[model samples]
Target: MTLSGGNARQALSRRIIDTCKAMNASGINQGKSGNVSARFGDAMLITPSGVAYDALKPMDIVLQELDGVCAPGQLLPSSEWRMHADIYRNRSEAQAIVHAHPTFCTALSCRRESIPAFHYMVAVAGGVDIRCSDYATFGTEDLSRTMITALDGRKACLLANHGMICFDGDLDRALALAIEVESLARQYHHARQGGTPVILDDEQMTDVLEKFKSYGRQPRD
Candidate 1:
């Protein structure tokens, strides 16, 4: 059944807050740097701009519709709301979006590099590599369009000279993917320091992608 009323709204509001706190605590985020959003009905529940995640309450979550109209709320939505909204409009499977500037990911992004297929797990982003979007001013429609194009076939992408963005079917998955992006970024940085790490060929990456389709599912008895 479709959830409604104050109970439903409050529950989702709390989830958004919790997800933000998790992002900060998990090292994928620092301070109020990152923003999070989740799909809720015809609108999206997103983090309030400039508020520290720990200080957020259920009432502080901002709910804005896809039509650009925001419901009455206690605070302003994140400045990057356009990106989150655009992601929802472009990707039917994306239920949650997380944007952050983890140390490694941000460093790589500043260098305008994408995480390559040096590791098989890179397939988790749904491509041969996590593409880096072209540099664009943050919070601008131009940036949103660039990010949308970068995310064409991937679940995540690094915002050139900005940070990283990740989305999944739910908040937990979105947050986990953000963490994974940072992990991959760190590993890739180290790999380059040692030498040109051998990258997995398209054929090998394709095989890994196929395996990921059913990874962790139990076998039939």
Candidate 2:
């Protein structure tokens, strides 16, 4: 049942390509500015570096060991694979990860501040506070460490001056969180333009978090 083997790898590869296409068409990503990966036992299936999402095929995905070794295939694994690998290694519940510079999420990430709990819906992100990791250059160990820290107990986080990253038990949930990050970021951006955004109180956020946990449902995030 190792993620390093046969059928699991194939399933993961197809999912990666399909997810890349879906994210691209939804305008949640551009060029090859994003990457997706899924845990298959002890290995990972990730989008190939610098490849167009639209052109991705099942076999175009790259297989990498948990230690980051890659087998013969199309292209190299993404530079951000470090971040993905770290998260998968640390978060037992995380089976899939998506990183994207979606318009709004990137806009908020560049603000030099945190994305506040402006809405209770933020609870869907595994917490009311979606942290923005300290700015780190992509593909660097520093960046990986920053992301790993920011993701502590949270399902989604923004990379300072970079983009958004979301992790979930499955690809669907991961993608949902990515989309939510973008939507919430857009809402926060517009609200800031209007005036200081209203943040949910501690008690209100707690209630939302509990209710969301109870429902066990996904809302676009």
Candidate 3:
């Protein structure tokens, strides 16, 4: 929805805060280590840096333009706002984004590893694998560039030595995608502990991706 008026903008801001709190409650993130944002017309509504989610008020959310500028007098935006801005600038379909340091996802990212197609569910990320961005210091344009590269043609990816990021058409789905990526990371990690996981071939993943187009929706009458 477009941020056409004060009420609408305020609503989106509250949703961003709620998503941040949910991230911690769901165990996908802890403390203020993650951020959430939603596309609001030409600007984005993002969580503020250093503010605990439990204490965030509607006005505390930062309304940042895609050019990286936030409105004057507002709290500072997330330290990683550049990455969110870059994603919104580059990915037209990203209506909402969730960036979190989920335990298993971060563990894999620390090793600079990508999640391969060890399970068909890997296709949910829009490909046969979830790529890990090259390491760069957080909050830098360089880090944003690498994330954009890793996220090419995908809805989710890992930030090397950092965390995971995902997006969808709304705040809820974006948060859900983050959780799903973490679950996938955990399963992949455990699978490796047993033995080398038998990765599905590209052809198999291709078929799975095709089916996902209609995987969960109910047919219209």
| Alpha carbon lDDT of each predicted model | 0.91, 0.85, 0.94
lDDT of 1 by residue, 28-67 (tens): 8899888999998878989889999999999888888875
Residue 197 Cα positional deviation in candidate 1, in Å, after optimal superposition: 0.7
lDDT string, candidate 3, 1-221, tens digits: 45559899898888888898889999999998999999999999999899989999999989899998877999999999999999899999999999999999999999999999999998888899999999999999999999999999899999999999999999999998899999999999999998999999999999999999998899899
Of candidates 3 and 1, the better by TM-score: 3
Clashes of 3: 0
Compared with the true structure, model 1 gives a TM-score of 0.96
Rank candidates, lDDT, best first. Answer: 3, 1, 2
Give a tens-digit lDDT track for model 2, residues 1-221.
Answer: 45645676677788888888788777889888999999877888888889888787778788789788987645888989999999988999999999998888887789855677998788878887889999989999999998888888798999999989999989988898899888888888888897887789878888988888768656785
Q: Which of 2 and 3 is ahead in TM-score?
A: 3
Give the range where candidate 3 is weakest over 10 consecutive residues by summed lDDT.
Answer: 1-10
Give the best candidate by lDDT: 3
Residue 155 in model 1: shift from native, Å?
Answer: 0.4
